[model samples]
Target: MRSRYLVLSVSAFLCFITLCNKSNAQVKLANLFTDDMVLQQQDNVPIWGWDKAGSYIAVSTTWDKKIYHTVTDASGRFMVKIATPVAGGPFKVTVSDGKPLTLNDVLIGEVWVCAGQSNMEIPMKGYKSQPILNSNEAILNSSNPNIRLFTVPRGSKTTLQQDVKQSHWLAASPESVAKFSATGYYFGRLLSKMLNVPIGLISCNYAGSSIQAWMDPETLKAFPEIKTPAPADSIKEVSRTPTTLYNAMLQPIIGFGIKGTIWYQGESNYDNPAQYDSLFVTFVKILRTKWGMGDFPFYYAQIAPYDYAQLPPYNKGGKYNSAFLRDVQRLDEDKIPNTGMAVLMDIGEQATIHPPRKQQAGERLAYLALGKTYNFKGFGYQSPAYDSFTAKGNSAVIKFKNAANGLTSFLKEINTFEIAGPDKHFYPAKAQITGGSVTVTSDMVKEPVAVRYAFKDFVVGDLFGTDGLPVSSFRTDDWDYNVQ
Candidate 1:
């Protein structure tokens, strides 16, 4: 009798093990494909998951009730590209491999990745002791089912991760918007209103992350000095560590369909400004290649004006000034294709690194998208960048490229202009509006070889385009800050 019972128990245990193995092979999708997710519209967007190797699966979209088929690869990963319709959906997408898994409330619309450091991570509710200008009002009025939000939680690892652990897409409501990225929310809000379509904004950011942190190993290989974190190393700053953020945070969501990415980073990389110029281009190129998307609209914010040297002891100056970093960001626009930058020269705060006015930053990015990406005409989106300067004598007349409406100081005295001779010593210069250009001259510095506008650790920009957008901090000379 005991032997018979033992045999029966063994048989049942083996059956249970078989059942568990079957369960392990169940179809599983990336966390980004959760309910309420949005895919890019009018494109072949990817829908992927894992199942038994060699298993065939069928994906059905409710928008058209069409079935797309694919076979899982040797690694148990299956991916199928489906053609999405124009921006409008609260449809269902179902995947089946014997058993069916369905995602509800799926949207097909403009999807944007909103990424960066603390400024981008700051929520609509505002951070403690620091507030986004008119955040409360924005949050209270931020209810719209047309907008969707998702945030990738903070993580860092040495190896590439497959998917996020705890994440879901939430429809924009007062409750959800309060925790969502302020810049992302504002940007999406404007897009939804202007385009009158569903808008999805993914907040993928870590506070105080360096540019190297977002770069992949292949992209950073050229820079030998930047090293990845090892298992044995004790990490003090997880976000600042190279490649770890890309491994854990960015890697998991690489192929997700995105219209483009809007970034507001570079504060942490301010100490090394020159390298950021080329690194930014390499990062953007590799990212587009990985996504298999054509050069998409890649708009980013020029780091806001702040007293970066005033973080602690306030002794930092010269080479550590963040103006160089902003300049590199400006130069990146020329290096990369389909790129734009929202200059924040007017909104910087001297007391805090987090600027209170994120709405302007977000809206500026939207204007770039509407004008450049969507080809919406009229109204200025590009800031008036310094174009060419002609030095006839002591006075140098600087021409701007996008100042079609001409430049203005709003009747305020412009005191930030500086003129420098070949010796590299810059002196305060009197700037006068010369029709569409600005002519500057300094009594102290004759025969100026270069000109700088609002070029300092922290300066409230007084110069602006007639469209109300401020000119980015600029310097014509490539000399290092300590060259003098």
Candidate 2:
């Protein structure tokens, strides 16, 4: 009996040793650690992967050449932090437990996660329905190896994934730029030219995705109105389903260090525009927490003017619901720190939702990042926003911020100003720009209690700052203006 027990114990020990050998032989790195990738500079970026439990892994970067080490946990997951140099690299990252896995042609530079709906997902090659403006010229000039691109595969899973199914980082060329996000590519190219550093863009966007679809489930639970149907057992269209894209596309790259994020979405959430203030604030908070990056720059484009109300041709008669959605996005500037909105009111088309002038939108976003986050001086990134109003007897004096250089009318006359009294019936108000403030008065309104500018679904308002940025739509009241 004792001899039989010894033989059984030896067999069990051998099996355990075999299992250990299998685990050790299969050291794998996260898919994010790929060739032609970019890492955030001047930060301790995490280099992580799987190895045998209790096995020590060594990590080194070609830029620094200092070796760092860490051991795998009981779950066979290992992560090591490596310091990156300043914004410049065509370096390599090497990790080893028993065998070395190397990521080559890596860049250490500014990396921004460009994420949102179809507007952001639109490629430079132009959509089947909407052709991008100046795309041919842009594509021809886009053969820069320093500008890298990585587009997250569009799909959804109910559960969070440690790695994306399949993806690759490609150096920007005419062919690659045609397939990548137009806004993302333009933004990166601008940064690369201005900052003189390699720019890496992680395009993690999907068409027709709502803000709820990109938010965490736990965060959405607090706002029941904004949350979608709960994640199910099987995968569906994650872009449309709440929390699915966050689980699949964003969750895998949550810890991957990035400089900031630029978003272009809101059409999908226009139905619940009122709740967007809270939902968007909550979304930014959740993203900051998940990324463990404190208040990183978050810039977004205001929803462009679209005929969502299906107004008749040559008709500006609509509920102006999309205008309200733009207002909600603007409110984030006051509610959250390190946030900005790119006003695309003038660039949008009345007939189509996808505007052709995407370069202007992208350049506007880059300007915000440069001026606000990177401390670029003398850079005009903001438009003249409505600051305050003073009722002066018959007329209301509307002051504006960012109008230090004064405001100008692109048209022969200033347009889209409406004034109302206690009864709240707005009528066209004659507006005249005097210095930095506009004096608005109407023969119809005796005592103007409220003022609105460009507060319609589609309006070609001529108000602009001397810097040439258009004025965003604004109203000084919180009235429930939904006409649905």
Candidate 3:
């Protein structure tokens, strides 16, 4: 009986040991630090994860053969820093405790995290009206071994996630770039060309994601008015809050530094133009603060024209108009230091949400970064913007900045213009240019109370500066849409 009891006790102890081992296995690091990872170049790379308590961790890379080491805290969290490399390569990282885990095919290159709405998320393959042949040729013939891509799976959570479910890095090829963001690819291509370095693009964008969805929950709590819940009680409700995208997509990769950010957003927030000025400023502040990147170059695209709701009051129903949103964007450019706006007021599709002209958009953003940040000369970084306006009887004369030599109409003839009176009645007006100023007049309004250009959702305006860049929408009135 004593021998049988000893045998039972031994079996029980073995079973308990196996259960403990299984639990520890479940508490592993995130997938982001797996094999074939590409750390950002010229930045402090953060390698972190969960492990057994008090477990000593060591990391090694080709850039520094001297293995960096750290020990897991009480919470099973560990972090180690590694210097960035200018060029990319096939590297390796090994972590050890009792057993060794080796991550292979690691690369050191430039990594950019792309985030925003559907336009930024639009894949190259399904873009309508784009020349499929051109994209196909570019993809198939791609030989840039240094260019790599890692796509963060789309997800929304009220709480921050330690790691994404699954992800892997892929070398840019025809098959890969086809499904990648066109804007991101073009931007990466330009950077790779100019810098002559390896580039890694990290895409963490969602279709139709609002500014509110990208913000932090605490940030949203600060603005009670914006915290409205979606019917399903999902994270989508968080979209109404500012900086929601930053909380989700950006927060995870905050310390994973890159060259800079190229933004293509703002369509979703156009309806609430009044709040955008403050919200945009707040967003920039949050990103810069969280990332510890002091006022790095943030280049964004101005919202392009789209079809307006053709109701009695055209600007209602959360629809987008040009001047209001563009003004908000301009405010960011003027107020935010080390920031640039890529004006695409002339390149947008009138009827489509996802404009197929992504190459131009990407190039324009690259132009700003090269000229302003990289100190490249001879690059036109800005499009002409309305500087000031003067009233002359029934007409208003408008002057512009960044006109280069002078302003010219891209249209065969001058097109989009409107004039309003004290009664707030607006009518189509004719426009003519002299030097860098545009003169707007209409026969119906003998005395103009205000003047507006490209105020509607879609305008056939073709005005451009001497540099051939489009003129952004402008307005001189502040009348409420419903009151009008």
TM-scores of the candidates in the order shown: 0.93, 0.91, 0.85
Error of 1 at 247 (Å): 0.6
Clashes per candidate (backbone, < 3 Å): 0, 0, 14
Against the unseen true structure, what C-alpha lDDT does each candidate score? 0.86, 0.82, 0.71
lDDT of 1 at 181: 92
TM-score of 3: 0.85
For each candidate in turn, give its C-alpha RMSD to the true structure in angstroms.
7.8, 7.1, 8.7
Estimate the overall C-alpha local distance difference test score of candidate 2: 0.82
Residues 111-155 of candidate 3: C-alpha lDDT, one tens digit per residue:
776667777777767555643225666667665667777777776
Candidate 1 global CA lDDT score: 0.86
Tens digits of per-residue lDDT, candidate 2, 306-410, equal: 777673333233334678888888777788889888888788788888898999899999999999999998858998888998899989999999888899886
**Model 1, span 314-393: residue lDDT tens:** 54677678888888888888988999999999999999989989999999999999999988898899999999989978
| Candidate 2 lDDT score at position 6 | 16
Q: Which pairs of residues clash in candidate 1, taking residues 3 or more apart in a chain or in different chains?
A: none
Supply candidate 1's per-residue lDDT for 419.
92
